[model samples]
Structures are given as C-alpha cells and as structure tokens.
Target: MNRPVFMDFERRWAISGLEDLTGHAGEAVLPKRDFLARLDELSGRVEELGERFGVALGLDHSVFMGRAAILGLTRRGQTSCNGTCRLIESGDGWLAVNLARPEDVDLVPAWLCRKGDDPWKAIGKTARRCSTADLIERAAMLGMPVAAIPFSRHPGEGRDPDLSSQTRRLSRLDPGLRQDDGLEGGRRPVVVDLSSLWAGPLCGHLLTRIGCRVIKVESTTRPDGARFGPATFFEELHNGQEFVTVDFATPDRLRDLILSADVVIEGSRPRALRQLGIDRDEVMSQRPSMTWVSITAHGRDDARVGFGDDAAAAAGLLAWDRAGRPVFVGDAIADPIAGLTAAEGAMASLLEGGGHTIDVSLSGAAAWVADAPEIASW
Candidate 1:
C-alpha cells in the first residue's frame, strides 16, 4: 500500500478559545490512500477564519476529526449500524446495503418477502436472489440509502477531475469577489439546517456544538433518517437545536427559513431545492454575509445517488484484504469526512465575512481523498 498515512499536525491551525466554548472531549492509521492534504484542507479553513476574524479557534484534532461527536452516544451504550452497511454480491454486480434504521430493517420482509429477525440475513438472501437493479428499486421504494459499488477504474488517473472520480459534481453557484460579513465577536449566528441523514446533519451538529444557533428544519412528509438511529444518538446529535417541520410543497415557508439564516445547510438535489424556490446563489447574493452549505451524495448537479460506503468505494477508497478482495475501509467514512469538511468550510465562509456557497458532495470528497498522491510516489 503506497498510500499516505498521516501528516504532522500544523500549529498555525489553532482556533482560539474554542475549548471552553465547545467542550474538548474526544478522540486512525487511515489507509495509504490519497488524503494528503485532507486534514490541512479541513483545518486551513479555520486558520483563515481565525486570521481574518481575530479569534483563535482552539480546534482539537481529537475532538473535531475523530468520532468525538458520536462518542457521547456510544458512551451511553448506543451504536450506529456502520457494519450493516456493507458490500454484498448481487445478481448483476456488487452494491452497498445500509440498514441503519429500524424502519429500513422492518421493510425487509415486505421488500424481499423474507421473514426473519436478523435484517442482514434477509438482506443477504434478498440480494443473492435479486439483481442490482432490483435491489436498487426496492431500496428506493422503501426510502433506504443504498448505492451500487462502482467498479470502473477510469482509464485516466488524475488529470481531469472526472478521471479521478465522477457522479458528485461541485460548483460555486455564483462567483464573484465578495466581502465577508466581518462580524467580530459576541454575535451568535443563526444556522438553519435543511438537511437530513448523516453528513449534512453531522455538519449541523458540529456547528451547534461550536456555539451556533442551529435550527433543524425537516419536511412534514419526509423526516430525518437519523430519527431511526438509537434514541440516545439521535438526541445527542439534535439535542441542543430547535426543530421545525415545513411542507416542501408549500415552498414559501422553507424558503423563508433559509433566507433568514446567517448560514444555510442543505442536503437536497438542485431540482428539489429549485422546486421549492430556494436558490443558494440567489440567497448568497441577497444576503452578502450568508454562507450556504450544500451536502449531497453526488454533486448537486448530477443525480447519481450514493450512501456512505458505496460512495467511498465509488470514489476508489476500497480496502483490499490479503486475498485482494475489496472491503470497506472503515465505517461509513464518507459521511464523517464530508460532514467534517462541510462544517469547516461553513465556518470558514462565515468567519471570513460570508458570501460563499460550499458544495460538499460525499462521492466528490471521497474521490479527492483517493486522488491524493501516495507519499512514496510524491
């Protein structure tokens, strides 16, 4: 394995006085995959924000990068279904199946007509019986987060962005030399999180811990998938936040919520948001100091969907066993990677005075990590 393992922690990346504000309570030889500047990229945003805002952000790697946010629930004897989300063989090809929620587990018998207590047993039997397409259909029908493992290793290695990875496409909605909001201190910014599931909500959770006034906005029809996780874990993530349910069909209410926020965090596709008359770029233009964070499976522009494990594999982050079989590197790593990255990006944009839209796509983030040059190769 020629992948780079770690980088020396940088000192200039300190966040002043954040320890007291966000209790420092936590925290990997990450595989030798391309993730050379990943930590720096995550922390550099804070450094820039600190330099500009005159606030020393005391960001601890143990807390911010590690599973600190999830530790609270784990200590309470709750666990996430990271192992359940695995690569399984299908009639056509391999795909990732995640039954993190009880609802997803309950839907198994209905989807595959397999009756058993163990969800994995039913899932494995169903996957063996069904083709990849069939499994995908059933997953969507049940609103499950599943993705087909991408097998194509692009002919080109690292020239074009697509050569390294595809599906998740990130683009700055409106480009211009903008000014920051220049909020010096003592003003707690309002963050309206219009995202669900792992990555987007995780970003919101991080922001909330760091003293942002985060408001989680869900749809009356479709609620957050995290609600299916352990009760304690779900509460840990959403504990200190306000909640509001809006009818996306109405659109006006959701639009108003986002526009009024100092920061906007969303995890929907472009078409979905557009249908609700919520434009990220338009919002940024309207409020110069506003930061909009868009989190998605693929990029906001494309509809190629994925969850954590498959998206990481789709971006070429698979770990090979001694026999050379491809296995998941870690537990739903893409979700945490994207979540932490989005949080840092959001904070950087806010601290530097705003007027930016950061698009953090799971597949894209995984692809970038995969493309990081091997340490020895470098």
Candidate 2:
C-alpha cells in the first residue's frame, strides 16, 4: 500500500486556492502563518491511519477550502472570512467576538449594558471601555462565543522557544485498553455522532468515509446549527450519513443509541450531556472498548465558551496584516482543523482497541499548529 505525501507543490496549490477563496475585494491577503503546513500535518496523520487500515485516503487542501467555496465566503481583514466574527480592541487587549446566531445579536444590549441599532458598533464601543478579561468572562457566562487574544508578535520577530512546550493539543483522558480488548479485527465500527456544527460532524464524516457506519443524532429541540447555514455546505459535510432525532427530555433512546456504538463523537461542554442523562464516565465504564471523542472550545475540564473564530483567536492564530494589525486567517479555521484532529485521534484510539476519551479542543488544536517553528517565517 502506498502512503500519502503532502508535497510542496500541493501545499502551494492549496494556499493559492485558499487565498483566492478568502481574498478581500479581489486582493489576496495571505495569513501570517503557513496554514497549509498545518493542514498537511493533520491530513498526513489521517492518511497514515488509512494506510494502516489498508484503505486508500486521498485527502488534500480541498478539505480546508470546501466550506468557503460552498458558502462563497471571503476574508474581511479584522472580521472573520465568514463575517460573523470580529476582532475588537478592548481596553487592555484584543478580543474576538462571534455573533453568529440571532440570539447573540439580541444579547448585545445585555452584554454591553447599553443598546444600539448596530450590535457590532455597540460591542466595539463597549469593548473599548472594558478590559479583555471582563468582556470574555461576561461573554462566556452568557454562552457567547468570545475570547481574548492570547499572544501576538511582530512580522520579523523570532518564534517563542518556550511556547511549544506550554500547551498540548490532544490529551488522553483515560488509560488505554489492551490491543485485543476491543472490537474484533475486520469488523466495521459503528459511530454514534451526538455532535453538531462543524467540528464533531466533520470528524464523523471523515470516519464515515473511512468505512465506519456514522449515525448523526440531533436533539428534537436543538438541531445542528449548521442546518441554518448554507444548504450546500451542510450537504457537503453530511451527504450520506444517517441522521436521527430524539427528545432530550426522554433520553433513554439517546442513551441506548450511544451505548450501542463502538465510537461516540460529541461537541458539547462537559455538563451538557450529563444533564441529558448521558454520563461519559459511566458509558465508558460499561463499554470499556468504546472510543469517546470529546470536542470542546477549551478542554473537558474548562467551562469557557468558544467557537471556531474566537477559539482560534484565543490560540493566537490570527494573521498580521501589513499595518501590523491582527486579522482572522480563514473562515472559522479552527473548526476544520479540530475536526480533522478529532478524527485522527478517534482512529488512533480505535486502532489501539478503543477504551479512551480523546479530548481535542478548538483553541488547543489551533495552538498546536500555530506553535510550529516553521510558521514563524511565514
């Protein structure tokens, strides 16, 4: 079997495509970091797993550029390519705020303790008066996707030597089971996808492409937010997967569906599912061979609210423009990256006979790529 290699030409091609898709008013704005390199590293892991499983994987730069193409999105400098997130200057520092939902827009008055015809203007004015910490704290408490910019360097500055060792992108939450303890060899695994939106669903989609049976489960009250997004984009991610809806108030059906799966993917804060009567520790204890992929904004232990744009900003993944201002790199760049990372982690766990909780966070995943030494020169 042949292994996939992300060649230099392919990386350049990917970058060119991304630049074309995300350019502002026909002018290309390259990101400060080599995002293609990050995608290459992540795709390589998935390809290696494909090779190990005797399956052919032909992923390329298209994975990162797909949603943008489907949604016809473009870069907006300080605003995200998707136009829902923005980089606001707080009193002490920079903050990223995403008002992707209508409810988020409605909460702007409460968030700033003042009302305005334009939510962004109100947020900007209020943010300038408040500290980054205060804004982020209040936003998190209100279930808003807000984050503080962690770090930024000038164009010619050298990479921080200590940063790479400071944070980990992927974490193992449980001890590994024996190699022979899980599903018997040559049997297809069933994945119960209890995640919505981009990251978790993308993970399940990739697993489905790799021969797993993925069943997407959404709550009757709260379906995947992506459903309200571009129809083409949503279809692109979930074209052939099976979808099931259940009432959370009555979670017996949901619990049964989760317990029957060999792998489970969820993109909720830790307590969301517990309130729904789905305890991860208990589920893992019952099915010791199962792989649980947990996707969060921060980590499983942290309660901070984050979305792709804000979390990526929190991870210091912003691009620096010519005027030395920080700008968003791509359209919710962390979402696809986190999704790919989660898929890789889930595959690795399954290959090792399951029984692991793979924790992959948006900020951490973006940081993992941002901390790359080679990105400093880009």
Candidate 3:
C-alpha cells in the first residue's frame, strides 16, 4: 500500500480545495463547474475504496457503490450533504445567496466519516479489537484519513498526560473509583450546564444519567447560537432532546439557582457568568463548596472568540487547509471535551477535600491527544 503517497496526495487534495477560496473576492463566487470538478475527484477516490471494502465484506458491489456516490455528492456542494465542507461562502457571499434559492449554492470538500454504529460502542469495540495499523488500513480501505482524523481533545482539557499523570498519582485508587460513586447518601447533586449544542447537552445528559439534577440556563438577551442559527439548531437530528431551561435574568433567580447547584459547567467565555450577574466568586462565596467550570473555543482567559470549528482547526483536532482554512471536527470537540472535563472536575471536586474552580478551554483540550506520545487514547 502506498500509504505515504496516498496520504500526501489526499492532504494536498483536501487543502487545495479549501485554499481555492482564500482569495475569493467579496463579489466573486465559486463557479459551479470548478466546484463539481473538485467534487468528482474526491468522489472517485471514495467510490473506488468503497468498492474494495464492499468486496471484502462480500456485499453487493452496487450497494456500496450507491452509498459511496451518495456520500460523495453530499460531501460536495449539496445542502443535505454531510461529512465536511470547507470554505463555505461567508460574509456577503453567504448573505447574498438566498436560502430559498438552493441552486446558487457552492461547497468545498470536507472529510466526513459516518459510523456504521454508535460511536461510543465503536470506541469500546475498537479498543483491544484492532491495532492502530490495522485500523488505519481499514480506514484507508473505507476512504477515511485515519491519521488526519483527530482523536484527542485540547491539551489538559480532560484526560491528557497531565490528567493521566494526576490520575496515576492517585494510583492508590487504581481500579477503585466507580463510574457512579455519588449515588448514595442523598448526594443532592447540582449541574449548572452553560453548554449548548449537541456535545454540551450530551455531557449534561450523561450527568443526568448518573442521577445529577441538571439545570440548563439560557436567555433571549444573549441567545445560544443553536437557538438562532438554523444549521446549529436543526442541521443535526439530535437537537430535539429536552433540557431544563432557565433565563439568565434577575439576580435573585440566578442566586436561587446558584445556591442550589453543586457544580456549574459553562460553555462560554470566561467572565461570561459575571456579565450575566452570576459571578464565580460570588457564587462560590454563597456556597463555599460549589464547583465552577467554564468552557470556550480558546482557553477561557485568552482574548479570542474560539468558535468550535475554528478552534478545532487551529488545535489540529480537525483538518485545516494549507492556507489555514478550517475543516470542523466531525464531533463538536469543545462541547464534549468541555462537558467531559467539567464532569470530571465535578467528580474530582466532589471527591475533593474542598470546593474549587476549573476552566476547560476547547483549544487546550483539543491539543491533549497528540502532545503526549506514549499515552494512546486517540
């Protein structure tokens, strides 16, 4: 297998398409012919690999071919398509194209890998089931760039080397801590979920799974992107799940909720709480044992607005163009990473001698996978 050659070409192929849009003038638009040409190139490679995988599994050639073609077309410029799309027409271009006029749209190649089954099950199933080399080989057969697909969250966001090392230090508790340990004794757990989007909700969902009472706070004053953005709200089918809601208005209401919470996990800028009148210090002061967590695109303290896609690209967790265009990670890393980190911090604090505050940055969490060579969670 020409693995190196294949990867080199694939990377160039991916980046070139993204870079093509770098100089797109405010008035210039991607010509349909040019866009289709790139799509054809990506589709051809994908279908060829799909055929090979289909044959290996003794499936009908046409079945896999159809799936591959559909997948390929979707990756191209189609609105209903999935996988990845870099260089989306933004600014005037985005605003110019009327959603009612679908024919005028254009899309760039973005890598998307749809799982055959549940991703979590895939994680556990893949573990001890195949070597990285074997997995990479399979990914190649299926037309996925396994090496390019990021596995870790930002550095130290969750279970990075620092975290692993810390956990190792507590090796005395090796094989001792339970996934559900606080269920006893009327734990009266409180989760202040400030995260939005699927990943954040999933994190809170998981906490609710372990009997944590979760209260989600939002406001029309500063609406969550998911509520305002159509792609964010309805693009994915998982957005329909129910979550407890609270408007971040009225200091007394905020205080009442804060006094009730044991853990607060927020997926917003640092000091955002204070802006909303829910200051961390004030909350902690009110409830000395409270645990506060903040999640963001960049690290919480940085003067950057790290949206999930851009931060994922910057952190190397998602594909990026040679000219620095972004390919959003398949999974929203910030949401899940922050959620998991917040959950872990909550758990740690619950087990701690006292209360404390934690800040989980999406960028830092995204870098955690590759920074440590020996540990292989990726």
Candidate 4:
C-alpha cells in the first residue's frame, strides 16, 4: 500500500527539483522558485555591468514584457516603441522587438532569442546595421552579450523605403572600369560603404561630396551612430539616420562587397585585420588592383586602442583637455581626418596605377602638423 504512495507523489511534483537532481534518478525539472531566483541573479549581474560600463540598462519590472507584446508592437509598426520592457521565455520561447526609433532611418531591427541559462542572453537580432563584429566581439570578450542584425530599405513587413536598390545601383556602374578620383561629373561617386564607426565609413562620407557614390551599409550587427547611438550630432534629430555605420549579412558577403569596391578602408589594427582574414598584403594580393587602406590609433605594431576622437586627441590634433591643461585632444578627430587622408591616398595610388596598401595611423597622420614644431612658437 505504501509503495504506491511514493510513485504518486513523484508524478505530482515533477516541477519541483530540476537544479538538484544529483542522485534522484530520471530527469527532474528545476523548481519555479529556483528558476526565478536564477533569473533575478542574472538581472542583478546585468545591472552591475551597466554601472561599471557606464551603460544604461534601465531594465525594471515594467520593462519586462511577454513575447506577444513585442510581436504586437512589430505588427502595429512600432519597433522601438516599447515602454521599457524585456521579453523572456523558457524552453522553446522567443521574443522579438524592434530597435528602430520613430524619427530615425529604421536602423534597429527585431531581436529573437530563446531563454538560456543566463537571463540577458541575445541569440540573434535584426537591424539595418549593428555596431561591428570586431567591436561586438571585443565587448563580448570583455563579458558582454551582443548580437547583430540586418535591415534593408526594402518595402516589406510593414517597413518603409522597402526594396534595396543594391542591384539597381550596381547595374549603373561600368562593370570592368575602375572608379576615378571619386569625382567624374562633379557629383558624388556612389560608394556602397559597408564599414562601420570611424575610419572606413568616415572615408566614405568625406568622399560622398567628392563624387563618391557612398551607400553606407548597415545590418543588425552594426548600426551607424547617427541613429542608434546617444542623442548627439546628426542622431540628435532622432530621424534614425542609417548612414552612421556600415553593415553586412555575413563576412563572406562583406568580402564580396569589398571586392567590388575600388578602394576598401578600415580602422582595425593589424592584428584585428589578420584575424578577420584581411591583412593589407592579403587584400592587395586578392584584388591586385584595388586600393586597400587601413587606419589605426598607432602604427601597425602599437597596442593602443582608440576611437577617432581619442586617437586624434592622443596625436595632439584636436586640442588638449576641456580645461586646456595642455593635455591631449578630447574629440574624435582621428576618424574624419584619417578617413579623408585615406581617400586622397587611395585616389593618388589609383592615379599612380593602383595596387597599393595604405596604412594611416592616427598618430602619424595627426603628426603632420607637429612635424613643423617651430610654428608652435606662438
């Protein structure tokens, strides 16, 4: 009579002890209390990280919503319209939320994910562009969970500016002829620049007015700052401009895009480029006719990590600190200047018959002014 009592109890309490099934036999489900506790721990960790990294998580109870709510918003044509909520699901659950801002260029995309052991895990995302794989990977290596997404101007799924004109644009250019000086008819050359952040993308923007057909590529993985970053500069309008960065669906696709480019530029360090299978020599070898440009804070060997402004400041071009303490420059000047320099360099190399690798260092480029120290007598 008592033998049947244990079997009945076990069947009724199946969701009781999953985390601690040590020697209890068959698979056991973790108790709801334990699961919730684990989730809380993860959320707490995320908060800790937010504080440490100067990031604004701002996640609270109201910020936590169901998957249905997110999908509803997407269907109703509101991606970044969520009023502070995080979607969560256990086993086979997934959540999708639009990252696009109202006045912006619909840069952000929906994110999809299944709950993992950790709370704030990003399985995947969809956006017009993301930050950058290198940046994301570096952030991840430093303990951040970042995902990339892809967004297009195509008119589909209730999206505006639908249908990417990539093919159409490609069709307009001469197939075999190389682009010259980025200015043929005194109009900006159409450049499909798929590089993000500083360096490469900045080069494209500078060349945009110089007759370069620059189409800043973006995906869920890498978004331009003009739309997704802090409310500053061009992004301050909240128009969600998608040109703040470059993006790609896959590395292979990005490579193909690069192959089609007359001048390919990047800001990654030598080591980073090598990791991405894009060493200067390799790129020159692969194309043998294209101009490959790479920019960095320091030369190829220096381990200095930098952003355009920081690099420019470090190189003493933008100006010293805010207090004017004779400190290093404090704005992001390296990227623009370096990008401009690279474009001209590419143009020069092309004019001289291409097949050259240009490595522009923020420090070196900015030092051009310092080269004549006598002018500092003022």
Candidate 5:
C-alpha cells in the first residue's frame, strides 16, 4: 500500500500518527522517535477487546489528521484560512490563533482595541502593535483562545520533556464488581461528551465509530463554539451521535446526565466543572465502574487554560520555517493527538470495568510530538 504524502507535515504524521500512534515499523520517508512508543500501545489493547468480544474496533491512523485532509475530500475550495491555520507575527514572536467560535471574531477587535470590518486584517494589525507576551496576557484575560508559538523549538509552556502524555490509573473501584465487565461484543457503551471544539469531541467521535452510543451534551448558554466552523468538518466529527442541550443552572439534572454514561468525556478545568456542580471525584466515587476521560490543555492537576495549537506550541510541538521561525505543526494538532490518546485509555478503562480516570493533557501530547527530531526539510 502506498503511504499518504503529508508534504510539510509528513514528519509529525510519521511520529505522532505512525510510529507513536501505530507501532508499525517499515521503510518510511520521515524521521522516527521513541517519544513514548508505548503511548499508542493502548490502541493494541483495543484490538484485543475486539478479538475477545467479536467487535470491529479497528483504528485508522489516517483519521487522526482529519483536520488536514478530511475536508479536502469535499468539493469546497477550502474553508476560511489557508492550510496550517495562518502563522502570523507578534511583536516579539509569533502566536497561533484559531477563531473556532463566532464570539472569537468579536474578540479580535477587543484585543486590538481597534475596530475593523475584516477580522484577519484587524488581528494582523493588532498583532504588530503588541508583543507576544502582551497579546497572550490580554487574550487570557478576555477568555480569547490564542497562543504564542515559541522560537526555541519547545512548547511556549515549559513542561518537563519526560512527562508522560497520558495518565491511566485505577483511581477508584466499583463496589459492585471486582471483575472484568464482560462484553457481549454487541453492546454499545454510552459516552457523555461534555467537550466542545476538537479534542474531547474527537474522542467521542472515535468511540462512536467503535459502536459507542455517544450523547453530545452542550450548555444552552454556551454551546459548542465549533458549530460555527466549517460545516462539513464539524458534521464529520459529530456525525452518528445524539445531541442535547442543557442548562447549567440545574446541577441535579447535569449530574444525572453525566452519571448515566458508561464513559465521560470533558475538557473544562476542574473549577469550571465544580461551578456547574459536577465533580469527577464525587461521580467516580459513586460509580467506580464509570470511566471518566478528562481532556485538558494542561492537566487535570493544574487549572491552566489553553487552546489546541497554542498549547501544543507551548508544549513544544513545532518545526522552524526556513527563516528560523516556529511553525504550527498542523491544524490544532494536540487536539487530535490527545483525542486519540484519550480514546484509547477510555476504551481500556471501560472494558476493565473500574472507576478509573485518564488525564489526557494537550500540552503533554504536543510535547510528545515536538520531542521528535525535526522532520526532513522539503
């Protein structure tokens, strides 16, 4: 079989998608790294589940880069920005911004303190006026999703290189069963997706492909902003799932909604969940067999907020352009990587049948991708 030509991003596809995500070794064009070869090994265990239970739980590595090529399969002449999400200049360094939401368009004017009919032009003009630090600080304060790409070939966030991309542990136990929740192979697990945008939703998407009954629960006040992105792409990720809207004001109903799931997928910070009257500890303690998958830009242990591309860059998953500038590896790469990684862990926990939690950090996954040697130059 001929391998897909990833062009500029062939290297990351080689590492994160190929070598790391799938333990396939062969004659390839891109460089390789052991940046936790075991990270994607969780996918192998899923194969075991399929064989043991007689289900078709196969994983396609190509799907991991859906942002780059999935939309190309359509007739549209590419939606919005050109490929690679527009790497622009900041006063000090370059920062990555994904206007994944309609509200984010309004943030550009507020960020620059200037008004313009064109969002990109206004963002470009405003970026020239301030340093990367200033823009990041201002974006953080305004709740705007933006990140600065670092030139040093590391994530803008300084996390230890040795940090594992995911944490899967037996955090709690089901009082009901000290046993494998035997699957009939025809059973569909329930997944409650409380995440928006890419990462967590992608995890839910992957789960649905494997016969999981996924329910995408969004807040009525603040729905998934990704609904404003390219229609085909959004639909591709959210297809084959039931969608529901809930009011965060009612904690009892929210708790019941999540508690009903066999697995829970979420991306908010801890306090944000608490504010909505949802606590992982309480939920897991109550139902130890529920697998809670928490996707954070940082980690569940920390409350830092981040978007996919910026957090990946901060975690150091970027290559330098010929001009020696840090370039975003691909479209919000950490989102998909963390999504795939988290899905693997979530599936394992579900079959194991325990109240276990998987902490899938976007920065950690990005760092795993960035830890590889720069791919071959074009």
Candidate 6:
C-alpha cells in the first residue's frame, strides 16, 4: 500500500517510539489495518472544524501514540503495551483483562474466587478452566474491564454481534442536543469536562487547544484515575485547563457547571450519572444549544464496563504475530482514538449550531477505524 509522502512521514513520526512496543521482539508485528491513516483522517476532521471556527489547529498522528512515549512503554506480546492489560486464554475463547487500578487488582481474588499472590498468574490459571463468556460476565458484574476477543481476519472485519446491537440502540437515542445559533463571534466556547482518563481528557485538551475554555471537573470521592499514572502523561492531556472537584453527595455545583457550559464531555456509564441526578435529557433541555460528548466502552445504555485495552480487543483491533496469534496493537489505543473522534464530533456539532450529544464508544470507534474505507483501499 502506497501512501502520500507527507502521510508516510507522519506515520513514521507517530510510530517512532512505538515501533518496538507493539509485537514480540524480532517478530515484526503489524496491525491488520493502518490505524495511523485513520488517525490522520480524524485529525483532518478536527482541523476542518477549527478552520470553520477561525482557529488555526495543527494535528497529527503523534497524538495517538503520545502516551507510549511518555510512559516509555514496550510491547509484551499477550500483555498490553502499557503492561496493565493482558490477553488470556480461556476454555472457550480468549479474553482481555485489564487491572489498571489498585482496586481492580484488589478484586482479582474475588474474580477468581480464590486468593493468589500473582494476579496475572492466578487469572491465567483460572481462565484456562472457565469459559470466556462466564469470565466476562463475572468481571462485568464486578465492574472490571474484561472482554472476549472475537475472531476476525482484520482489525474491523468482524465485530461482536452484541456490539452491533448496542450501536443500533445508541443510534436510536435522542439525536444531538437541541439546535441553537452557532457560537457567537469573538466568544470562546466553555467546556465542562467531567471525564477521567485518556479519552475524555484528550477531548477536553483538544477543545482547549481549539480555543475553548475547558474546565476539568472531578468528584471528590472518585477523582480521575489517571492521576495515579505517570504525572507527565496526565499533564500532557490536562495542561492549561481549569480544575475543579465536586462533592458527589451534593452535585448541584456539578450540575450548575454543566448548565453553564457550551460543551459537556463525560465518560461515565449512563446509570452512574443518572444516579447522581444529572440526566442528559434534563440538562440539554435546560440549555438547548449545548453539545454533550458521551464516551463509553459500548453504548450509553450498555452496563458493561470497558477500558482501552479490552475495548480495543473486543473490537478485533489487534496485531498479528509471526505465528498468526493476535497481539495488542498499542497502549490503550481505543482511548486515544475515541478521544480524537469525540473531539471531532464535538467540533462538527458546534459548527452546525450545537444541540448534539456525540455518543462515542471506544470499541465502536475502534471498529470504525479498523473498517475505515481508507484502510481497506490502502
């Protein structure tokens, strides 16, 4: 596949630090699809939106692999590039499990129903005896990010049937926020970012770069999970953004912040926000011109929890090794991809006069990129 000279340079620069971190050493693993091209396409969309808003924004594929560079991550074959997630073989199929949080590690014994010193070893031993379906169901119940690796010839060749159904359900939801007049001349958009981790924060960061006033909000009880990660990586996505902490018990301040924003970015399950008395419909009703970006593992209605690694694996976004076995493509790739897609969606909606809820799912975004026409033609 021949690409433009500029694109070739962008791909090489994007994958520079990531070259030795995707497949096993000396195996030369590559993704079934060109994820860099997909990223380039999304970056172009964001750039176009910036132009419409009279902002000069320069984006490239380097954003997708920025985390790997910050963390100095390397590929570990069945293990995720970030070293927090793993692809384990179950009796029926393969599953990706991510123990990204300390609490997630604490729940490993309960997930396996036995105590063990090494979580990965214990998980692998128990997974060999249990069916992938059962393992996934139990992990979902525990709020852990676990996904069954569906079979596919290419990154987006075949998706999990359940994911397709969820996507359809998402499509039928209330279409975008109520339409309003586009952003006023000389007025910068206000963005309330209530999302944690990479995807949502990256969206906020991009918006900030695009001349938006972004406020990063977190609950006092449940702050951003990324705070525990590498400090520099966290700062990269959040620099120059306002920070606020709200008390979940009394989230009136959070509601007020959402109501006062031109764009709202959140990455929580639907029910989680509903339980906190922050309904999307209600909020949008109060502010018809607002654009809400909802990022999730699946659709808004699906209760299944997912992180970047498991969600990408579930979407069949994997690299093939020399032996033809699947290996992870990059470090929580779904997160960055979904983040860029969400930002682009937000920008497009705003350019169209607002009143839109951009429902971006990590797995769904990965599937779209994997199956992008550009990748197929290339």
Candidate 2 to truth, TM: 0.87
**By TM-score: ranked, best first:** 2, 6, 5, 1, 3, 4
> Residue pairs in steric clash, candidate 2?
none
Which pairs of residues have clashing backbones in candidate 5?
154-316, 155-314, 155-315, 155-316, 156-314, 157-314, 288-355
- As a TM-score, model 3 comes out at 0.49
Tens digits of per-residue lDDT for model 6, 1-378: 455744564466335545566787556465656666666787787777667665777775567777877887777888887788888877766788989878899999999999999999999899989977789889989999888887733455444445563341122222234344334465888999999999999999988887789999999998998998899989988988999999989988988899999999999998999999999999999999999999999778778888998888888778767665778877888898899889888887766667888998998888766664433223
Order of quality (lDDT): 6, 2, 5, 1, 3, 4
In candidate 5, stretches whose alpha carbon ends up further than 4 angstroms from where it belongs are 1-53, 73-85, 109-131, 153-182, 185-188, 226-240, 301-305, 373-378
Best by the lDDT measure:
6
Model 6 vs. true fold: TM: 0.87
Candidate 2 off by > 4 Å: 1-16, 21-27, 152-166, 169-185, 374-378
User: Which model is ahead, 5 or 6, in terms of TM-score?
Assistant: 6
- Of candidate 1, the 10-residue stretch with the lowest lDDT total is 20-29
**Tens-digit lDDT track of model 2 for 1-378:** 111232443357345466654435445555655666777888998887766566667887767777877877777778787788888887767788989888899988988889799999899788888877678778878888887776534433423222332255564423234334323366889999988889998899888877788899999999998899889878877877898999989999999999999999999888988998889999999999999999998888778767888888888877666666677767787888899989888888877878888888888898887665433331
The residue-by-residue lDDT of candidate 3 on 101-207, one tens digit each, is: 12112110111132433332333333334343444344334433122222232333322112221111111112123344344665657776767654455455545
Worst 10 residues of 2 by lDDT: 1-10
TM-score of each: 0.66, 0.87, 0.49, 0.43, 0.71, 0.87
Can you tell me which runs of candidate 3 are displaced by over 4 Å?
1-180, 220-223, 227-249, 319-331, 370-378
lDDT for 287 (candidate 4)? 74
lDDT, model 1, position 245: 95
lDDT of the structure predicted as candidate 5? 0.65
Question: Residue 216 of model 5: what lDDT?
Answer: 96
lDDT of each: 0.63, 0.78, 0.41, 0.38, 0.65, 0.80
lDDT of 5 at 112: 77
Q: For residue 72, what is the lDDT in candidate 2?
A: 77
